[model samples]
Target: MNTPGTLYLIPTVLADDTAAQVLPPQVAERVAALSYFLVENARTARRFIKSVAPQQVIEELSLTVIDKDSTEAQIQAALHPVAAGQDAGVLSEAGCPGIADPGAELARRAHQLGLRVVPLVGPSSLLLALMASGMNGQSFAFHGYLPIERPRRVAALKQLEKQAISQHQTQLFIETPYRNQQLLDDLLATLQPGTRLCVAASLTAPTEYVRTDTIAGWRKQGAPQLHKQPAVFLIGA
Candidate 1:
């Protein structure tokens, strides 16, 4: 019987152009050795793999798509190659897999099946933003994406602020790129004047911007024009 192959949790660069600046050499080496991958987007995955391993034969690698809409059966089928002794990797569309990503399901299944799972280091926008935010990093929670409606979004912001204040923990979340400016407006409108808010926009990209300040400070300085940019938002006491 063939031995079960190891499952590699590969992290892709946060931005397409920042791979050279953010990716570690070991990550590329690990990616180069993989024969198959379960990725969020095959096109982006191919582009990313080629960027890291320029000499790699892209067409030779097997890829299966695993997004938020992927079913359990599809996830299991994707990992079948690994169970049959063919090494496989999980590549997220951006940053690390399994953190606010659908790849978590794949990793959980791999563990249940007793397959060896290895996570290689790479740029994680969440951690990077937390590190730069000057907030309480020791205690933090990532609440992925707030509500879309104004009333619900405002209530969510208040709840997040209360949690941050009461527990003295950092409340981190993200928004759809197109709604970034609206979210910023909502934050300034709903949050207390003295409440601290950190906006980390286009992280690891040429247009990267990470700033932490009170709501009042933000109003005075004017809002950052962060429309349609991948960003992380953090709030704390």
Candidate 2:
């Protein structure tokens, strides 16, 4: 019986300079060693690898595309190399894979096929936000993105707030970069005045912004320009 090769859940930088600022050298080392990779974006993955290993032959690497909406058959095909004893990597567009990423499907399939799953240490905007939010870090949840519809979105926000207030769990979520300011507006209008909101924007970037304040406090300061900026938001006790 052939022992299955490993599947590495690799994390990419959250921002342009994070390779130098936040990532350890081992991240590039491990990625460079793998010949097969499943990535959210081939261009970005190739760019990232090239940034870290200029000497690497980017043209020779086998890169497969996988996103949040990939199917089961697609996931199985991506992991086939791992089952055949070739170490493979799964890379998300940013941050760690298999958490909130579609690359998670590959990891799960790898496990079912008796492949070794290895996760590398790297920046996770969600965890970073929780760490600096001063909220209930020990107990928290990441809801990804709330509903797009106004009524449903408001309902979802209310539910998350209720959880935060009653269970003391931090409720974390994100919005489309373009709709970030709109989301903030909805958050302020929907959540209770006393509820705490942490807005962490452009994480690991030059223009990073992380602030925790009550909904009322936020309204007083006027709206921030979060449109088109990568951000993470948390609401909780």
lDDT (Cα, tens digit) per residue for candidate 1, span 64-117: 999999999999999888999999889998999999999999999999999999
Best by lDDT: 1
lDDT of each: 0.93, 0.89
lDDT of 2 at 143: 94
Q: 1-237, model 2: which lDDT tens digit per residue? A: 667889988888898876878888888898778888899999999998888778779889999998877788888888887898899888888999987888778878888988899999899999999998999988999999889998999999999999999999999999889999889989999988899999999999989999999998999997789989999999986
Per-prediction CA RMSD (Å): 0.9, 1.0
- lDDT computed for candidate 1: 0.93
Which 10 successive residues of model 2 have the least lDDT summed? 17-26
